[model samples]
Target: MTRVVELVEHAPAVGVALPDAVGRALAAGDIVDAVPDPYVPGHWSLRAGSKVGAVAVATPGNDEPITVRVTPKVPITRLFFLLGYNLDPKGGWRDGEVDVTGHRDLLPALAHAVERQVDRALRQGLLQGYQRREETSLVVRGRIREADQIRRRFGATLPVEVEYDEFTTDIAENRLLRAAVERLLRLPGVPHDVRRRLLHQRARLVDVAVIVRGHPLPVWQSSRLNSRYQHALHLARVVLENASVEHAPGALRVDGFLFDMNKLFEDFVTVALREACRSFGHSARLQDPHHLDEASAIRMKPDLVLYGPSSAPCAVVDAKYKAEKREGFPDADLYQMLAYCTALGLREGHLVYAKGNAPHAAHRVRHAGIVIHQHALDLDQEPSGLLSEVDRVAAQLVNTPRV
Candidate 1:
């Protein structure tokens, strides 16, 4: 006998129950959809949709009761498929036959899945493109591990080992996605510069981190990073826009490019921020442009704004990419970051400069109860080596009492 199960979201603890067939379909990562039918008695047809996250399966008829914990305010679509019986050619009904079961909600599910997939693809493409720009990058200084098992009659023994390699690839590909979109916009016969300018604007919209004491580094491609950026952009846009639409191929491509660019910027910032946090035993979030307060009115935006573990302001960072470091100090950069610290009620801020510039001494100044720091990012070392310097700097920040 086929069982009828009702899927519902529970309060306090949010989760969803999955049937055996549905679980299997999700695990297999099928492309689900609903289509109009003429020959069939039903008005609609049900099928698979695009894949996003990984899936796990449960044994059939076990009924152990499955539940999935979900993020609050995040909408998830659940699809139902028909299983159990069908009719035979000999005029007898067959038992335990599974086929497509129609659901009114399937259309929206398909749209959501496609949207996510497209976003993911675009982000991945961008990261891959950036990594391709440079090769032989330095690996971060951290232990890496993999697992192995030795089987015996009594029991299986699991063992693991660690290695330090020169390759540590974790940069996201959103930047590459932006590049692709710009390329498409610049394609011959497309007269609209608006699209091209929009693409450029999107490319410039990125979170940045400035490493103070690191060697020059190489760049590499990462598909995983690209996908993540794409998803983040999609979520951000969707939340900001508050709606969905049919899957447009051109729109998908454009979105993919934007997402990739966003991801690249995010990754770069994350690494630098992580290094700072690790050194100081603190953490930070990319500041939202919408949350700027009156104190920071003069300094509109900063590359990075760090926070203490208690959510207290730590430091403000601004990143610059220049082939040559300025003689003495960059006054404009210093003033801008100092303004951010003053506005955010922070005590210290930093100006991080890119590599290939003439090295200058670190500068410190106190203004309006805040200290502004100017340091250069050494791109001459590997990524890992550069991160080590970041960690040291963060540690110093934490050890030193706030002045």
Candidate 2:
């Protein structure tokens, strides 16, 4: 029997495990550690600093292995929405068929979303009818292959290489889609229905398209005739470029497949805060890089910087993922933000963290005459509520002095 352990980001799950199979699997996955309890004797719990949204399968030597999945404490669906927009603003969850409701595993959910997007695109058309230069033998027109005319198939057919506009299922777009679906099919724990859909979609694609493994697909532009595939093409590119496989003796570990929650959080906050500040005559600049030293070798990159309509700095914000224990012991984030403020000649700055204990904190430098306001954006709230928090940050910047 296999056991399933689910954990939230920055949270731990504690349980007792059998020594032989389960214990080894936990060790392999880095999901659990041995804990000695006076009452419970031998116990195991989650690792100290596992990444959020990372799912690992722990395989014991012989028996069925346990699966451990970690989800963000903030509503997982909201994070996906953020990721969808960040990846492509015009393409997002609400407009597409990406349904994550009641999803047990984020990886499989992403795969299903990708499959659905490709499936939807195919419905518009089989993505064929593209003219490609072909080299083959024919009885009639096309450039004849004189070498093949006498050497091979002399009297049967003409060997020719010609460019013809024809309707065939073999094309690069279909091949790339086919490759991505095939890759997803190999992943373990995909939903049964999703697997069936993947299989069905793969069959619809022409089989002869060459599978160029480990090569990035070229980006193709869409015209008025094939404009329907622009969104689907972007989704397919993201999935194919990011998804990969890992194999072992008796197990397959699907690694390097996850949405980076930290980046997602930063992008969401910056975009929202920027939009909010627009009403107040301030535009937010993201990742504003400046030379910190006279030599121009040292550079400081602030996550976000607000500028007035006149093009002057208003406030600087640094988004930190953990902003707490997980960020390590040193107070590095504060030091970095201070550098940003000093470089930009601003007296006030802001630091935003994902909500944790002590939701709001303020710090004032004694001699430097600078202020750092720290606020936590509560992720557990609804999207509207979360944006309202950003609204507060934007409002604070409006009143900030230009000094």
What candidate 2 gets wrong by more than 4 Å, as runs, is 1-5, 13-45, 48-66, 95-97, 128-176, 207-211, 221-227, 234-256, 278-283
Tens-digit per-residue lDDT, 41-124, candidate 1? 433333322211111223444544221111111122111100000111122111112111221222223233323333445443
Model 2 C-alpha lDDT per residue in residues 1-403, reported as the tens digit of each score? 5455665655655665544444454455444453444465455655423344333344536356445556666565766666666665444444235777667556676777777788778886686655555456454444555665556665655445344456666766677677778777765557789899888888877564757775657556667755655556666665665453243324444242444566777887787777788898788789988877878899888888898877988789888766745347676667777787788888888888887733577788788888888888887776668778889988997776755
lDDT of 2: 0.66
Lowest summed-lDDT stretch of 10 residues in model 1? 78-87
Q: Score each candidate by Cα lDDT.
A: 0.36, 0.66
Can you give the lDDT of residue 230 in candidate 1? 40
| Superposition TM-score, candidate 1 onto the true structure | 0.33
